[model samples]
Target: MPDTSSYLNSLPAIFSEDPFLGQFLLAFEQVLTGLDAAKDEPKQGLEQTIANLSKLFDPSAIDTLFTDDEKTLKAFLQWLSGWTALSLRADWDTGQQQRFLAEIVPLYQRRGTKENLAQLLKIYTGLLPIIEEAPDRPFQIGVNSTVSSTISADTAQIGGGTPHRFRITVTMKSSSTDELARQRQIIQAIVDLQKPAHTYYELPILIRTDTMQIGSRSTVGVNTLLGSIPTA
Candidate 1:
């Protein structure tokens, strides 16, 4: 049998062509570090701190806890989705505030630009503790590409330029962690695979997700991210 150690050692070299994967690993490390910072603080007035954050970022779900005027749902979403950094006050112990912030990390859906960027930094801070307990392993990944060549280059050309396009497929696999990890990995991989530099000469890669079942008979359901890239 081939030496497993050698194969494992070779993964980094084999993956060198895709340097962006390294960036992802670094980003994930940052996320883990953030979680650690959130856990070191003490707890005092934990409940109130949670309540304040609930009103600010997760108002849609926390709205029932307070009156209408107290709901900052729309504004919070906008703030997170925008491109600015966001700061909030905490009256409770550090752990409690961290937990509450972790729970509301899903508010990223509502963020748009820089505000959303700020929200991400806050989340990274809060998620640091949870990562400390987990072991980091070599992440496994797979890639596939397909192209349609039936379209004639001459017929598909635009304004005497390159042909319009064909189709490209990018299939990937990653071990599941939490739901957030799974979703984030998939999105990042798709973006990396389909960047315009890669796609201008090549067809766009479509990311596909799949599920697997274990035990006696296995089951699986595969799906694609919602929106489609325009072919050019």
Candidate 2:
């Protein structure tokens, strides 16, 4: 239709170069162009998307796009965590989640022990974690015996709480209720994952102040934990 003369010329001279027929062909070509145009955006969009497809799955992107609607983002991340065989807390923000995604698949297999529990708590919360196994029993290590001012000896059994009872204490860098609550939730999630199935635990979070600490006080949650121990 656009090159009606060329079309007619390609055919034998016997074919008529009828104006109406040329016009009809032109309209038909216009209709085809419109149909293609209708699909062009999505089709081209898919091509570009396929080229840079990694951004869709990028863990960093998870925060920005989905953060506005928490429910949707949580749902999406749930699917991702499920695939990775990870037990993730819903409250974890973008950065923590990104870190979690970056961590190895073996973390799930490495759960259910004090070593792994403390390691994971440090990783997720960026705080020192002290894990005492059978805390009700008398302390085997000298430092382990020192109870923090926060702990109530009367409430806590001499050895621990339950048969498999353990206690975890972490000093808080921020006294803000919001930050503390968020950390508490994450800590609980990690504890839930790492603790033995039959065991239960007590989590004591202390609000640390600048006044307390120099030498031995600096090392808590590892070999030495500060209980009623004197501060330097």
Q: Which sections of candidate 1 miss by over 4 Å?
A: 1-51, 59-62, 65-67, 70-72, 83-197, 201-232
For all predicted structures, in order, the TM-scores are: 0.20, 0.48
Q: All candidates' lDDT scores?
A: 0.34, 0.61
The window of 10 residues in a row where model 1 has the poorest summed lDDT is 127-136
- Native-to-model Cα distance after best TM-score fit, residue 19 in candidate 1, in Å: 72
Candidate 2: tens digits of C-alpha lDDT, residues 116-175: 777778777778777765534354455355544233332333445446677787877646
**Pairs of residues clashing in candidate 2:** 135-159, 135-160, 136-158, 136-159, 136-160, 137-159, 147-227, 148-227
Q: Candidate 1, TM-score vs. the true structure?
A: 0.20
Model 2 spans > 4 angstroms off = 1-78, 84-96, 135-162, 211-232
Which one is best on lDDT?
2
Shift of residue 210 alpha carbon in model 2, Å: 3.3
lDDT of 2: 0.61
Q: Backbone clash tally for model 1?
A: 27
